[model samples]
Target: MTPPQVVVVMGVSGTGKTTVGRLLADELAVAYAEADSFHPPANIAKMSAGTPLDDADREPWLDAIAAWARERVEHAGAATSSPYGVRGVRGVVSCSALKRAYRDRLRGAGPGVFFLHLDGPPELITERLGGRQGHFMPRTLLDSQYADLQPLQADEAGVVLSVAEDPESIVRKAVTALERAAGADNGSGQATG
Candidate 1:
């Protein structure tokens, strides 16, 4: 049996991380998490109010999500009470993870943790954000997100997937990318993609 995978579907806000992440989780039959759900009320309030969070404000939030990832990997191959029942110990989470440092922090969670970066033009993302409703992040913060976004570096264990495709297509590509990464894991206890 293949070992579990912990993947972070990452990108700027409005880039469909949650949509694609959930779908990807379903495709992989893994448990899923939304990084937003781990935020403290203060962070939500801040974003809802159009305030972009600084690194200090984001530290704890990142730590919380990282902890969740760590816990999931630590318990790989074990049974857990979850809505997704009897999954293959794999885990997927949606997070902005706009910076390399942020991605590194998440990677520190555990081994075999990889990322699926959803990227697209700012105009496209802006349009999506404009049509969005009932979300804490405002369209105004889109610029900040774009500015903070650091593309996946060479050494990162991940792939940069475009958001130009439909959500289903993106999920299909992500699953394939993840599978390739897993298969390429070369026994170094890390994802090689």
Candidate 2:
């Protein structure tokens, strides 16, 4: 059987993951979720205080998002238990899945957990972060994020897109690439675009 699809829009902060993810979800008519919403109050407070969360701090947050992803998969045509509460077999989510281990953990959500990695130069991301407002994550944490990021390996089922492109262009390219991957897989469950 062909597995249900879940596209993970992943990158460090200020990489436009949320904007592009929402656009992609809307264009594809799939449910959308923000990884930040899965974070606990303590995690928010820690980041608000300019403190970078250690692995333990992010464990619960990642688990919550993974749970949501799995819920979307297992429910298939049934009503989703997520905030959208819609009946859909597909989903798009924005998450800073910097490390390989974290992405692997998220993959447990389903067989079709494909990732869309957004990346750009440090200076570009830093400027974007500086201009961004109302976010708990501090720009100072960007260095740590880059340090921890492990780009997708050749064997991983995913694609890397540049953040330097405009949002509309990026969304268009992402949709095209992911669709091509979906059609090319032939029920093999390999969706690397």
Candidate 3:
């Protein structure tokens, strides 16, 4: 079996990060975390007011998530076997790691921090965002998110999937691609999946 790792389902809001992350966690049989859960109330309030979060405001929030990832990865190392008899822990988390720097901060938690970026055109994302309910993120903030989004660099260990496909198809591709990558690399990003 491949070694444990954290898969961060990332994208701008309304890209189905949380939905796909939950499904992926179930399929991977690992812990699932919502990025918003790591945000401070102040951050939520800011976004609720249609305000974009600058890096300074995100520092603590990112730090909190990073700390959680570290703990999860650390505990994973100590686990001889999981309930599924796996060797270590794996986690699927939904985070809007829009900027490369934010992703780098997450990687600081440990190795094997893979990113699964969900991307699509603004028109589609705008539609989805409009349909979403009970969410702090306003559709007005989407532009700022798109502006801040940095596509995955060549050095990063992750894949980017388009949101043009249906949710199930996207999730299926993600699972297949991630597993293949793990198997091909022995959990390293040395070869194509």
Candidate 4:
């Protein structure tokens, strides 16, 4: 059997990471997690107040999320006992792992932790962010986020999908890429979870 997969759906703000990650988890029959939920209240407060989080402010949050992913990978069964686990299955998470170091921290959780980068034009993302409501991340921060993002290297075990297409199509392409990477035979894509 293939090893369990821990997928980190990563992108700048408004790239549909949450939406795509959730759908991909559902398609893979696994749990979905939101990395934003793990952020400390202080971090949220800073972001809500229009201040970009400095690396110092983000370390704890990143470590916490990585630990959560680690727990899921280590204890494949009885995942319900902890939010960190996936309830007897694999899982996906939406995270803005903007740097290689951040991705490396998450990868420490397991060998199968793969990243999926959602790439799209700035105008497209701006439009999407504008239509959203009540999100703490302001569209004004997108430029800062873009400036901070370090694209995944070619050697990394991950795939980047364009976000210009419709949501369903994007999911389909991601699942296909993941399935091919995992070498699974199931229709939805290989069981990376």
Q: Give one digit per residue, the lDDT tens place, for model 2 in 1-193.
A: 2333788999999999999999888877778999999999999999988888898998888889999888778776842322232223388899999998898889888777878899898999999999999899999999989999998876566778898889988887776666555555464333332
Question: Model 1 Cα displacement at 42 (Å)?
Answer: 0.9
Which candidate do you rate higher for lDDT, 1 or 3?
Answer: 3
Ten-residue segment with the worst summed lDDT in candidate 2?
79-88
What's the TM-score of every candidate structure? 0.88, 0.88, 0.88, 0.86
Cα lDDT of model 1 overall?
0.79
Q: Can you write out model 4's per-residue Cα lDDT over 89-179, one digit (the tens) per residue?
A: 3688999999888888887776667788898889999999999998899988999999999988754667788888777787777666665
Query: Which whole-number lDDT from 0 to 100 does residue 11 have in model 4?
Result: 92
> What tens digits encode model 1's per-residue C-alpha lDDT throughout 51-83?
999999999999999999998888767533224
* Backbone clashes in model 4, listed as residue pairs: 5-192, 179-190
Clashing pairs in 2: none
lDDT (tens digit, per residue) of candidate 3 on 58-120 = 988888888888878877644433333433447888999999999999988887688889988
- Which wins on TM-score, candidate 1 or candidate 4? 1
In order of lDDT, best first, we have 3, 2, 1, 4
